[model samples]
Target: MRHVSGLLVLAATPIGDPRDAAPRLSEELARADVVAAEDTRRLRRLCTDLGVEPSGQIVSYHEHNEAAKTPELVARIAAGDRVVLVTDAGMPSVSDPGYRLVTACIDADLDLTCVPGPSAVLMALAVSGLPVDRFCFEGFPPRKAGERARTFAALATEPRTMVFFEAPHRIAETLTAMAEAFGPERRGAVCRELTKTYEEVKRGGLATLATWAADGVRGEITVVVAGAEPVVADLDTAVAQVLERVAGGERLKDASAAVAQASGLSRKVLYDAAVAARAT
Candidate 1:
C-alpha cells in the first residue's frame, strides 16, 4: 500500500491560444501551495492573461533543472503541500518537463491529479486526417542525420501510425530521409504552428511533403506518418524489392538489412525469403 500526503496536480496549459486555457487550470494555479512551472515567466504571463494571480510559491522546473528540482518538489508534496506542475505549452510530461517530477511524486506515494487543457498532440492528430485510432508519439528524432535515418529505418515496418516532433530547420531533411528509407509514396502530414494564427497542415506522400518543406519553413512542427503496409506475403515482391536495391549498388547484406529493418522481420528470415524467392 502507498501513502500520499498531498495532491500533485499536473495542469495542462494552452499550447498557443490563451483562450484555450480551461477554467480548472486557473483555479488550480490560484489555489496550489507550490506551482512548478517549466517557465515561471510564462506562467506569470498566463496568470496575468487569465486575470488570476497565483497565491502559491512559484519555482522554475524545466529540462535543465528537472533532476535537481524533482526531489525537492517531491519533498514538498510529501510535506502536505498542494503542488501544481505546468509546462510552457501543452500537457506537462508530453515531450516536456513534467515526467521526472511526476514519477518522483508517484514514487513518494503522493496523490496525483491533472487539470486537462488543450493538447497539440490531439489537435494535430485530429486535423492530420491520418489514422489516429492506433498511433504512437516519437517525441523527437535524433538531431544527427545518420542517427535520425537509422531511427526511421527501425520504424519503417511499424503497423500503427506514428507521430514525431521536429525542429523547423530539420523538418525537410527528416522528411527526405523518411522518404528514402520508408518509400517515397508513404502517406504523411506535416502540421506547423498548431493552434496559432499561422497554423498549417500539409498532407501528401512523404516525397511530396519533403519537396514542400525543402523551400524552408518555420514554427513548431509535428509530423504524422502512415505505417508501412503489411508485407506482401507473396515472396516474389519481397525478393524483387531486395534485388532491386542490391542491383542499385547496395550490398546483399545491406539490402537485406534495409528491407528487414523496414519490414519488421528478422534479416535471416528475409534472407531466407529472398533465397526462396530467387529459386522460384
Candidate 2:
C-alpha cells in the first residue's frame, strides 16, 4: 500500500485587482497547515490586502530553493499536513515555482488539488481579439534574438492561438522577432497590466504592434498571437511557383527545396518535374 501523504493544494492568487480573490483561496490560505509561497513577503502582502491571516506556517518556495525544498515539503505532506502553494501572481508553477514539489507529491501518492483563481494566461486569451476556440500557453519567449526567432519559427505552422508571457522591457524586441517569424500582417494582441489600474490591450497586425512597442511597453505583459494560417497544399501550384522562381535566375535545387518545404511536397519530385518542363 502507498503512503497516504497529506493534501497538496495549489492555489491561484490574483494577478492584479485584489477583488478578484476567491473566497476559496482565502479559506485555503487560512486553513492549510503549511503555506508554501514563491515570495513569502508578497504572500504576506496579499494576505494583508485581502484581510486573511494565514494560520499555517508560511515558508519560501521559489526557484532558487525549490530543488532543496521539494523533498522536505513532500515529507511534510506525508506526515499529514495540508500544504498550500501560492505565487506572487497567478497560480504556482506556471512560469513559477511549485512544479517540482507537485511532481514529488504525485510520485509519493499525495492528495493534491487546486484552489482555482485568477490567471493572466486565461485573462489575456479572453480579451485577445484572436480566435480562442483553440489556443496554447507558451510560458515565456526566449531572451536571445536567435533563440527566440527559432522558437517562433517552430510554431509557424501552429493553427491554434498562442499565448506567451514576456517582460515589459523585452516586449518591443520580442514583438519585432515575432513579426518576422509569423509574418508582418499576422494579427495579435499585447495585453498589459492585465486587470491592474493601468491595464491596456493593444490589438493590431504584428508589424503595427512591433512599431508601437518600439517606443517601449511596461507592466505585466501577455502576448496573444494568432495562429499561422494553414497553407493550402497544392503541389501543382507549388511546382509552377518554383518554376517561376527558377525563371528569375534562382537555381532549380533552391527553388525546389523552398517550395517542397512550404508545401510539404517531395523536393526530388518537384525538381524532376521542373527538369521535364524545361526540356519541353
Candidate 3:
C-alpha cells in the first residue's frame, strides 16, 4: 500500500504589528488545504492586512466550540487534507485554542508542523529588564481577588523569573496583590501595547509599580517579575527539607528544586544526597 500523508500546521500570528508576520506564515496561509482559526473574522482581516489571499477553507475553532470542532478537523486531516491552525495572536496552544486539535492529531499519528512568528511573552521579557536566562510564562493570573492572591502567593518563592498576562482594568489590583505576595521590593516590569504605537515598558519594584498604576493602566499588558532571592542554609539542612517535601507527596525532582532554590544549594548535590539517603 502507498504511504498516506497528512499535515497539521500551526502558524503564529503577530501579536500587535502585522509587519512581524513571518514569510513562512504567509506561504502556509496561502497554501493550506484548510485553515482552522480561533476567529474566522480576525483571520480574514489578518489576511487582508498582510496582503495574502488564502485558497483554503477557513473554519472557526475557539474555546466555545473547540471540543466539538476538533474531531471534525482531525477526520479531514486523516483523509489526507492539510489543516492549518492559527490564533488571534501569537502561537496557538499557549493558553489558547488548538490544544484539543493538536492532541487529537497527535493521537492519530498525524505529522504536526509550525510556522514560527512573534510572541508577546518573549517581547515583554526582552524589554522587561528582568533576568531572561531563566523564566516561566504563567499565561494569565486568576480573575477573582482571592484566587489571584493565592496564585501569586504560591509563586512567591519561585526562583525563576515569571511573566503573566493581565487586563488593563485589573493591572492596579494585580500589582497591589503582587506587592503583598512577592514583596513590595520585588523588581518587575509592566510591558503594555507591545509592538504598537503606544508601546511602553515600566520597570520598578512592585510597590512602586502599584503606586504608579493606581490611577489606571491601559492596553494589552504583560508583566515580568524578578525571581525570589536564593535562601542560604547548611547542605544537611537543605537535604532534610527536600526529604520532608518528598514525604509530603512532592516528587523528588520537584522537592529538590524547591529546596535547592530555598537553600541556595546545587540541585544536583541535593538530588544526589536524596538518592544516597534513599538507598541507605
Predicted structure with the largest lDDT when compared to the true one: 3
Model 3, span 1-280: residue lDDT tens: 3216778999999999999999888899998999999999999999999999999898989999999999898888888889899999999999889888888888888878898999999999999888999999998999999999999989998988999999999999999999999999999999999998999999999999999999999999999999998878888888888889899999999999988877888999999999888888
What tens digits encode model 1's per-residue C-alpha lDDT throughout 1-280? Answer: 5655588899999888899999999999999999999999999999999999999899999999989999988888888899999999988898999889878877777789899999777888899998888998888999998898899888988888899999999999999999998899999999998888999999999999999999999998899999878764444566677889978998877888878766656788778777676677
Candidate RMSDs in Å, in order, are 5.3, 5.0, 4.3
Computed on alpha carbons, the lDDT of every model, listed in order, comes to 0.88, 0.90, 0.91
- Writing each residue's lDDT as its tens digit, candidate 2 over 76-105 gives 999999999999999888899988988888
Clashing pairs in 1: none
TM-score of each: 0.83, 0.85, 0.85
Poorest 10 consecutive residues of model 1 by lDDT?
Answer: 230-239
| Candidate 1: Cα lDDT at 196 | 89
How far out, in Å, is residue 155 in model 1? 0.5
